[model samples]
Target: MQSVTLSLFRFGPLRARLWALSQMATARFALRAIPDIGTVKLCGSGVGEGFTPVPDTSVYAILATWPDHNAGRRAMFGTRVFRRYAEMADETLTIFLTPASARGRWDGQTPFTPQDITLDGPVAALTRATVRLRSAGRFWKQEPAISRAIGKDPNVLFKVGIGELPLVRQATFSIWPDTQTMAAFARADGPHADAIREVREGKLFREDLYARFRVDAVEGTWGGVMPDLTRRPTSMTNQMKVAAE
Candidate 1:
């Protein structure tokens, strides 16, 4: 599966409306023409310190996954619909492509079991959760501790931008061995519980958005990339194809 994250940044109060417009436009095109496209997941809009904050006039969007490079290239370059959406943006657009190798599944509402998650394809399981706290002011002080606690967990792949924006104070992105592991972390309320309490008691961020997915495809850099270089290694782009085969 080919996975790509398109992040748009908008500045000013019209951010939300502009973002909504882009989403609506993209959804229409994706639903009709984008093959193997999964659910049109909406995230990062809720009020929380850990969420992505757009300028009062700025907005952002994340697009993940296409079946292959051709499909991905088609959606971004060959298609008029996506190009039109790009024209609506005011600032520079950023895109990241990564391969998603399925590790597991998340069965909503129940404790996830090993048997419940499937890794039948080259798909990555993507799950995101967010909560709004009552005391965002005090929560800012604990950013260091929060980052430390999260980093201690070996299962977590990466956590970036700690204490960056006031509205979206913290954001974490990680890869797990399987769905069961991810579920265990979610259900076993220790560190997670403590963090939730901190947010709630401190009134940090409000609203929690949670989602899990079976990554169907990925595109772009699978191995890695060197930004200083203009040309990417052929092996990196083809990594997913090799793995899927």
Candidate 2:
């Protein structure tokens, strides 16, 4: 599947309201077009320190997929439906669209395992709590540590960096088994805790954190142009052969 990361950057006082309005507009447009186009599986938003590593304002993220890159681009940038909402975005909006280069070990459809657990509760409960922390700009700093910890867990799946969309700062795209695993990592009293504390103690941001999530239905070309699932090869040749005219 192809994925696009849209990051909205805003500062000053009215950042939160403006960001919310823009997302609302985008969601409305997405919902209306779902029937004609592919599904908009997941959308997420969060808060983070700007490029300077200091809490800036807010960053919004949306994870959308389509049968192919061409369709996805049309749904997002080509139509006036999304454009109406795009106008509401802050002056400094930045967007990046990248394909899932390679599928991870746990990338495809599969049941989540115990390693997905972040807390000893229901998935919904954990997702809510972790989302709160993310909105507070707590999870951004601890990403590396969190990734390392999850990597050690055998149940954990592959980690892919979809590339960052520069706006308020750097925002990335990653897929997890479920919100439950994500919560366990965020709520743990580890590096994530320290990161959260930094935000709570300091009046770092001007508004609440923002994020959205959607499950994706992926299709289309694999290998060659995309990263290899097995390993990063030194070089890859096009596998699709053209027919004689």
Candidate 3:
């Protein structure tokens, strides 16, 4: 019954954006005070579909874990920090998820507890890594190609690059219609696959975690468009294709 929430906030106007940036430090205090909230991370996005050095000042994300779906919803909709964020954002999207599979660790601690349930519909993939300082240059060089590959993929329902720290600590969250499609992108002969090979062969990440989740629900809109998880292979594909075009 454990659940996770990934909330994306888009701020408009210089003041709101500045406030969002400040929350990167200040929100942690508020989040820590929440009773049922477990592991929480406030992340900043990178430019143009993420995986870059330049920061996107307008967008930020909150990733939190809770005891159950109800607890997660309460924390998101009822907590002071989340309420303040909702009041200021131009548009926001929150995805409710149940971990289906997980491995490795974040900040040396496991964040998600996977359930013994089958994931048959839309699945989300999250990968977080702390890049080695010496491997930073090589890691960054592959980012553009990797971003371009994922950007061109029609099977990807949603994707964004976010990180706890600039440059060194990086993470990606993506949604696909099913696990097969998600795995296809990773297994394909492309920049992503190449990067995976290098990461394993060269020890690029100092710490890393990869997790898959069942998409329980999606709320609100991202970039003025609400992601409809109800529509499966057909409509979703068409919608994404149109967005890409």
Candidate 2: segments with Cα more than 4 A from true spot: 1-16, 19-26, 29-37, 41-44, 49-58, 91-245
> Which lDDT values do the candidates have, in the order given?
0.42, 0.36, 0.87
Worst 10 residues of 1 by lDDT: 105-114
Residue 217 alpha-carbon offset, candidate 1, angstroms: 14
Ranked candidates (TM-score, high to low): 3, 1, 2
Model 3 root-mean-square deviation: 6.2
TM-score of 3: 0.92
**By lDDT: ranked, best first:** 3, 1, 2
Candidate 3 stretches with Cα past 4 Å from truth are 230-245
User: For candidate 1, lDDT tens digit of each residue in 1-245?
Assistant: 44444334343346546665456445555545556543333223322222333323244444444554445555565456556545655442433334323232222222121123344322223333232454544554554454455557665432222122335433444444456666666566565667668755665554332334333223322124322211234465466344444
Q: Report the lDDT of model 3 for residue 17.
A: 99
Better of 2 and 3 by lDDT: 3
Q: What is the TM-score of each candidate against the true structure?
A: 0.43, 0.35, 0.92
Q: Which window of ten consecutive residues has the lowest lDDT sum in model 3?
A: 236-245
Residue 91 miss distance in model 1 (angstroms): 3.6
After TM-score superposition, the amount by which residue 239's alpha carbon in candidate 1 deviates from its true location, in angstroms, is: 12
